[model samples]
Target: METRSLRDDEVMKRKLLIIGWDGASFIALDGLIERGCLPTLARLRANGFSAPLNSTLPPVSAPAWTSFITGKNPGKHGIFQFYEVNPWSPKALGRGQRTHMAVPGVVVNSRSIGEAKFWELMSAAGLRLALINLPMTYPPAPINGLMITGMLTPPGARQFTYPPELAEALPPYEIDLNPREKDFSSPDAQFLRRIRDVLAKRTRVALELFRRERWDCFVVIFTETDRLQHRYWHIVDPRCDASEWAHIEADVVDVYRQLDRALAELVRLAGDEYDVLVLSDHGFGPAAIKRLNFSALAERLQLFVSTGGWERNVRRAFNRISSSKRRIYKYLTPLVPERFLHRAEAGLKTLARRGVKAKLIKLHDYIGGVWINTTEHPGGVIEPGPPYEALRTQLMNRLAAVRDPATGKPIIIDVRRREDVYHGPYTTAAPDIIFILDDEYGIETGGRSSELILRIPQKNQGTHRREGILIMSGRAVRPNVQMARANPTAPGIEDVTATMLYLADVPLPEDLDGRVIEEALDEDFLRRRPIRRCSSSRRPSPDVASEVWESAEEEAEIRERLRELGYLE
Candidate 1:
């Protein structure tokens, strides 16, 4: 209350509602709206200008949503991947240093994040906020108001809420999800019922919180859309269909309708006073996951690791196992430590290898291709001089040239070096090479030993596309405006944090990677309140890095949950 600088009217009028739909893309949303399935979302879009926001480099949830919340790239935020490099444990590197791979697993933590997320800043500024089920936000921190973490949370945990005792009042929250629930191939009644029940429960919890608690900035994220899209992509996706479960076509439609109803209820609860902003981390397309084997390909190029056999077997076995990727990944982590992970190809380089022999550390963001072990690590062989540059150039060419044996089309559509996309202190942690797939043609991230290796699937299922949904509608917004690509201009996920800060009449830090998406706002609104920019020197946990909160048990549990949801490898 002491930080209150606003008048009574301004305090009451400055309310912002943020709703996040994990994996919601404009492509999928437009179809649903046209068919009259998601009328609530349709109306909201009509009220405000919206566009398909460009997702982060990997287009995964952790980095994408974190970018939206922090207005920074993976390099600055240090959340490039989910399971960041955890080379800690004193003995981990024979020192006191500890770390987690920024490659993937959105930094699995059972405790609140060390970084100062936007909500934390708001809390500091004396604004009441409620964050319900936002991904990569586990162990809800103590905010000025209620806060609930999302999919990144481990279930059966009582301390998930800011109050810590909030779960005891509800009908048991469903914080975790598995892949089979959305997997239409083996669709069952119980699984479908469970998914519906879980979503309903979460919605109920959110509704109760909103009514029970007074708040200014409120955010609620629904992640089931992402889980469903990833698993049941075949059924809901217009690009593909199942003649067998053809009866369930409407079931997928019902899911969207369910969400629409929920949105309507929330909007109704908010009345006309609130400005609503709906968005998604990244768009979803048919699964074109290709588990690229940089190790096998490198070995053939005479640049293979000595431990290639062990790593390859781990990957192959993971594919063979019917269990969720969670358990299998846990089984794989202990086999190799992060320090020794940057290994050189055997025989060719014994203590010294020629050129840079690549070995993928792990496919944390499953779709993100092989992360090469280079001179970036303490044990790395690829020196940063001419040798590193020469090897990267060669590897990029070889990977980009990979072709689909069945289609004769190139498997990789683009290739990028780490330095090209990310910058900051953690820049060296990025994968040596990131290769994009030609998802349109059904090229997937296939593994070396998998049956789908170097081949397209019978039907393209789901993959993370760069374009996701971004709808802005509220009192200060223009109506019926569909964003156009007249110029090379498009808002990115990174722009969200600044936009929110702007809407709340708060000044923003200039160090942010994204600029305010001014086009989405009404002209009159902008004229009245010009954007105010500050410096990063004043901005700092939204500064948390180099911490691993989840113990081995918790990491295994959450990883399995992510695997069951098909988010991890």
Candidate 2:
């Protein structure tokens, strides 16, 4: 990879350095910061603006990062999931493609987002930019500087790096935790060292790139914070049931301490002239309960009542035999790699399609997109107009009403119609009904083959929370002010771009969904920066000139990875 030698004139422009610490929740770290366990972070916070930035609607990685880069909602960005279900042909489900077998969707990558990334915009404006291991940046888009994509780039693909030869020149990057090892039980000492090992590799790679590259704006995302939280939150989280570990382990704190050192190194590299902003895609917390199944409840509501008796009976008989009300899902799913389970699950969906299409609601593989398959679907029985609306309402209400038998508290945290959240050309790609998950319980959506509603789809130690962390420090930022956490007025992930653009002296785009977080800056800094907003000259991205390349093999790896990470079952 070629390194840029900054010209004397070019070196003086205000530089922006963004460090993405995915899934670092501020709420979960109150004690750690106050106690000085994370000295570098505490120092930065004492001198900078720290706050909780709201995540995307689903509070997941891809969507949150996409929103941050484009300053647009999923409605405008078209990246609702790591993979988006192609809605072109309803009949396309059983087309026998290896990729769709486990996922049945396109990998949401650089090509998939309908809006241009802020880095791309900055590149077009002639500022050099380097985006390192950023999620959804696969098949690296044309940027002025080097671009190394994250896991979505898939394994064994050379195009994952920009200046394509960079792949040939540099060592490989580890973008995710291996789904094969150190699951929830990983907190044991040896596995804890594995966490350090992975983080070390990332820090080494990032430092090499940061030193060897030249750019006005640079971004690097560290995911160990998020992955460790998923696998070992019990060690650090106060809300977790594993209180025994409070005294037994400090791996969580040690892991964060390593990050603090890594961050301190980056701050030093950035120098006094550059502004550094640290943030996460989503927050993290202990997951006490999983979502309950509501397929049986929907069935009882006559949502599945169709004209055919035999198809319904055959499907019901199969479901009854298989449904231990999810006993199989709870005990068996963890024993196998999630890919085989999805293949089995997809095979069941294929089998169900052979009989009558008796199911009204269908889960796409595990708990991704939920479809109604009402009158809109081919050869469907549910009527379209008044009947469909009523059914959707009933399903939402019933799903919201589901509660833990023991706890008596509602299992759902939020319920929404796809229409309510999304408004764009690719709206159909979204699940018709969206379940905002509760940390307490997991949800299992019934497919055309499934019979019972209540079952355990998957398990994890932690889950995504709505509030991620943001700490911006520079001579221009205010000292020691915390951005309101859980307050409705806090900035969304999308605001990241607008704020950056403002700092870079680029005209703020008025059309974006985000507002500049003026509060995060010093009053004198604001006066010096003098915020300005103009009608956006930007337009939607051009359609892909070529179909984005995808590997069925890589797609399977991603599916297994997502399942292991608890984003999917």
Candidate 3:
């Protein structure tokens, strides 16, 4: 490709603003637009280049957002899910205490990302930036401008913002919704109120920073959209009876309405001077309610071996006792004094935890990934090479053949081996077998249940889909263009970083997996600023200042939040 280098003044002439709605999907947005609920987004779609943004293979937030910022596939960025098998140790680890073959895995964090982010590249090029609420940004790295860390930030942590002193100046800010404040599985007026409050505070802080901070690039992500969708999809989906959730239906729509207003305000603040790009990491849809016990299926297939049957029996017995306790609690709650409630609850929780003891290969609930007992881990049963490959193939075939007894249709839509789906230096860290369940079915990894599949009422009625929303609007972009016509395959989340770099006139890295979205840019802009590529990729040394969690309790707190949000089992 032809390349050019722009002058310092030329690089400073253009500015870009990226607005992220974490899991906004056109599937639901289209209906809202028609109903006149999201006028700001509707106007952007009509005036700008709009298309469905494809996400990563499993399409979960951790990998998808990492891909969006790095211009790399999950294999290259090294975050396949919210959590993966810890490759270095078999000891019990942080976050949900998830284990496989006696090895506990760690939650994905800033240190987990293997590739450099585009903003880091831009910062190196002397561009100012304001990174707000981006996931996996805890222990904020030094940037040219300012940053406020987002999801996975430890609760009550004082070091969430870069330029540490900046934290004191902003309005009261929250990194994410507090999982302790609300039961996300069921709808409550208090939960909706909290969501609105968080949105308002985040918007207030973002606007304050946008107006006060110096920047060439500004990025802010609103995670409330994804949070609301996960809990309230049943209220919004047309197929579901709205009357069933009538109490919170209007409040749910109002949240989106608030988001629409926030979008309008942000864009209005940008005015006509800045090029704007709006997108999502992945889309949202009605969750599959039928839970498939993947570990149970693996056990039945003889691919996974538990420590012993005694553990299973003990777990089942505990479950029965716990169920009976719940029934008794319902009768006693109104009669008993409130002072003793906390002690009783804590005791019950202890009893439940005592039941789950054995560690084995199992499915991950968030991403539908099956961690295999390969020779890579200590005490692994399946040997590497042909045996590993054969086991993966056998499991994939068996999973694909599984059918729903009532519908007589396959429950799993697709299955793939790790190598076939991902490629890069970090591929070895990924799950052995990844599968996609039908939209009507959800998979569970916990081996607490004896049945392979069960019809259950889920508290979280929404889940992520592959196709997200993308809109590019500004003076430099072509007006009213449909990205699908120019690019047969919709642009993936990985493309956003390259597009941002191109707009900022930074030289593209040779190893990037994305291309500049030329079809969406104006011809004059393209002609005036030709593409430039560097000879080698840049891998900066890890910053010593970007520290991990300070204590185990802090790490555990974040994991509990993820579990409450349904990201962890």
Candidate 4:
């Protein structure tokens, strides 16, 4: 009996699988490959095309991921920072308390984001897509297919957005920031083995679902490379330590090899049944640590009160004051009765209109830019006030003046308005101030935990590097694409969304800030999308600690194996 081969031209079977790895840098990739470690990745590169993937400015995960999904900049998408505004008065928002409440009339969490995300566009076009582990998608929405939230949301939070009739027949799904806790904690050898096992398992689940359910496009992510690099860069660098470095390098190589093997398996399973596209949101690299005290700079400008030990005392005092106020607010909120809350809120809004600023004192010591309340940006209650603009300029100038004592190099390399850094009409409540640290230096503002500052020993031992990689191969991907040609320097991280959407034959939303990379596709490829629709689908279960301890036991074995392999000691 002869068996038919599944091929890309089959037309009958058309789908796309996208795997997003967090912080998989081309810098790390080159090192691993030159050392003869990542054969599978190297082979894949030989068979396809790969280049440095440009990341978002500020080089963080949340904004970059959002841009990748929405094809818009932070200005357009509005998720500028990790924490949102305190929905209640500042007095009510404190540490360990959820700061922002769902403000009435605001359906989406971030006001900066525009509608027309990748899945939404695809679903509306009538194509079924499975989006697994994409970040910032918590509180999962009603989708045409599966929508498992990624890491930023708290664990075990996947709630089904589709109805029971639509969801009942789907495979059980589980999602988390990092799903393999036990294996993650294990040693090198076992960790590698566990990663392989998990990849095999995840791939199997995805394939089975694809075949049984008959979905059009599917995407699953693997973030293991990112996790390993953050903890092991010192070990892998040739210019670093001499004695123990060699052993660590071997372990790092093993991770690359494992990912390569996993890719091979995915390819085998996909078997031309779908077009495969692998990408990293941003690439990885060598980073150094540097602490900067913003309050110290503030003192130089006389904005902050500082004594010999005044900074520590001030932080403690602020924490206490903020805590006391929140507890009182929380207590009064219920006691005053439901009817009074609205009336009080209305009165407060009236007071706000009359220019009665909230009594809460903000030290203005935080590292990020403050939003200047002005007619230019509405919904803002505070402005620089009379002393504001001058004070802001003076402070920005002083921060720019800071330099490394030893090297005499400037600490802040650039300080631009958020509007200047990002381009789009959907601007954020722009930070009143913006400061960029010297490469490898983290802004360690004063009023930080004593443990964070006093405990960490080495300076310039932090992370912050440019030069991430981008790789693309599969249906209609142009061959021999070079990094310089395929990606121009300083490409907005959001461009990935437009590029992917174009590949999937989805129409570009008019408001998107990014343009599709038309040259990246083969000329003969059709841009017309296939017709498909999702009847109903269930959100995957949130990851739970398995009742079966066998996997946990296996994880323990892996950690020990890693110790011997010198990945961790």
C-alpha lDDT values of all predictions: 0.65, 0.67, 0.75, 0.51
**What lDDT tens digits, residue by residue, belong to model 4 across residues 75-97?**
66655433332223232223211
List the pairs of residues colliding in candidate 2.
289-440, 289-441, 290-440, 290-441, 290-442, 291-441, 291-442, 478-522
lDDT against true structure, model 3: 0.75
lDDT score of residue 302 within candidate 3: 53
> Where does candidate 1 stray beyond 4 Å?
1-13, 85-107, 110-115, 178-186, 289-295, 305-356, 361-379, 440-460, 484-488, 537-547
Which regions of candidate 3 fall more than 4 Å away from where they truly are?
Answer: 1-13, 86-88, 91-104, 185-187, 304-366, 483-488, 538-547
Candidate 1 lDDT by residue in tens digits, 366-406:
33444444566555555677877888788788777777667
Ranking by TM-score: 3, 2, 1, 4
For model 4, the run of ten residues with the poorest summed lDDT: 98-107
TM-score for each predicted model, relative to the true structure: 0.80, 0.81, 0.84, 0.67
Specify the highest-lDDT model's number: 3
lDDT tens digits by residue: candidate 2, 1-569: 12342342234246888999888888667767876877878888878998888887667788889888888888777777665644323322343321112223544567877876788668767888878878988878678888888856565565777888877776656655567653555545666677788788778877888887556788999887877777667777765567666664576788888998899898888888788899889887766444444444344434433223565565666578466736766777779765566567655434444322123222222233345555565545557778767767876777678666766776666678888877765566566677654555544543332333344433556767778988889876788887667877787888888888777766677777777788887786676456667676446654422255565576676666666554543
Provide the lDDT at 65 for model 2.
92
Candidate 3 lDDT, 6-36, residue by residue in tens: 3643743568889999998877787788999
Residue 137 miss distance in model 2 (angstroms): 0.6
- Measured on C-alpha atoms, candidate 1 has an lDDT of 0.65
Q: Judged by lDDT against the true structure, how good is candidate 4? A: 0.51
